[model samples]
Target: MTASSSGALPQPRRFLRLLNFRDSLWLLAPIATLYGIFALIPFALIVRFAFADGGTHFATVLESRILVRVATNTVVISLMTTVVALVLGYILAAGLWRAGPKMQRVMLAFVMLPFWTAVLIKNFAWAALLQDNGLANTILQGLGLTNGPVTLLHNRLAVIIGMVHYVLPYAVFPIYSAMQAIDRKVERAARSLGAGTPSVIWFVILPLTLPGVYSAALLVFVVSVGFFITPVILGSPADMMIANLVNYYVRELVDFNAGAALALMILGAVVPLIVLQQSMGRGGRHGAH
Candidate 1:
């Protein structure tokens, strides 16, 4: 019995030594510490403030009519942004997938332009172009489309436009990745089976790319929900989103607790969507295998 116990202790020590060699926790320590300090600590504080006084801050937020409207606007605007971004992104991805090497580089450059530009700069540019008598209106008038300037700026439509532009690249990369993963032989097989171009895409390509589409939609929706500057710059007061509401609570109303509660509420809403997306991604991997 003594010998068996002594041997088992050495086995665990040897396993630990092997694990230390294979997986180095020290490499992750710096990033883990930074994340804990910046993200985890703030999140913990928000959660703590949210539940203070037996959750009275949440009760206050729930009772406000303005908050309800803000929530609705957040959902509607995010949905619109997600749908438009998905459609445009899919088209761009398809074009990228079909283009030759030269054209692919050009298209990829355009797709990445927005990523290189700061979000504030992009939003400001959109605001300029969408405003009354701006470039779009100027061109429309030049083409005899409208006699006078249209109310294009400071509205929900403008908000959606800016968001779609900002998020289009995100959608493009994922869908393009999925397209790249598809086997060319399968496409050729379909062609040999007398399938037309449209039929091939509809039956094979679209189905294979559904995972990417879903991923893009979720990413866009998640990003849209967290939009702070775009809506403020491009949208009117009526188009306030949840992030704006949190800002109002904290900055305007000077209610840190309520702001934390609303922020926590946003986190609560987004977490389930993230979990769902992760599960779908895992399912897609399994399907691919």
Candidate 2:
């Protein structure tokens, strides 16, 4: 009838409560196991391959020049594509943001239409348009833009164009959403305070949407580093990305260790960039605070 009567039921009751809490772990155990099996295990294996020798021993994996060149090419193409997509997508998103709802809907549909088409179809379409004697050059020649067929496909430019097209939606959607989230009243208030149109945008809208631009740029950059199919169809050997090189190692050379090393290299480069970006963002936020 003392304190035990009200609060403490019994030792068995406490044991049952403990058991209930411990039972919750069972719910997560399966998912954890699956993640370990599918994700962690494969990653561990790839890392091991990266350190192991591709030819004879585990130590030879880091001694490949092809891996070095491929890694460099991947970085260059990814940066170029990210810059192009970010600029074009930012402009388009801005235009869409400024448009009326009807025009916005139409523009959005147009932007999204390409995504609905299959990637292979898009690649072939680019091939048809950009091939030396294809539609684009024919039109150019017809219009006296050039005297001969322009070399468009099987070049770095073609690779960049394809990557931009593939990554545009990724770049635009985030920035557009960020822009849409900005308070119109902030802009109106700035205008009311005698801020010019450009000033209001530069000072208010741009700053507000910077986070989204950063996010979209990183997303596009990461994806571009791994681009393969579009570049293979539209680009020459010089434009080969890390993913394509990795594919060649795995399939053509039948060197799984080298492929894994290349894959790990790509991951290594991207992870640092991401961390740098996040660090900069946090520092900015802290400074602002």
Q: Quick one: best lDDT, which candidate?
A: 1
What is the TM-score (0 to 1) of candidate 2?
0.79
Q: Residue by residue across 3-69, what tens digits does model 2's lDDT show?
A: 4435655687776686687787768888988999999999999888776744342334456667677
All candidates: TM-score? 0.91, 0.79
For model 2 the local lDDT of residue 268 reads: 78
- Provide C-alpha RMSD values for all models, in order: 4.6, 6.4
lDDT of 2: 0.82
Candidate 1 Cα misplacement greater than 4 A, ranges: 1-19
How many times do residue backbones clash in model 1? 0
Measured by TM-score, how close is model 1 to the native structure?
Answer: 0.91
Model 1, 200-254: lDDT tens digits are: 9999999999998998889889988999999999999999999999999999999
What candidate 2 gets wrong by more than 4 Å, as runs, is 1-41, 51-61, 274-289
In order, the Cα lDDT scores of the candidates are 0.90, 0.82
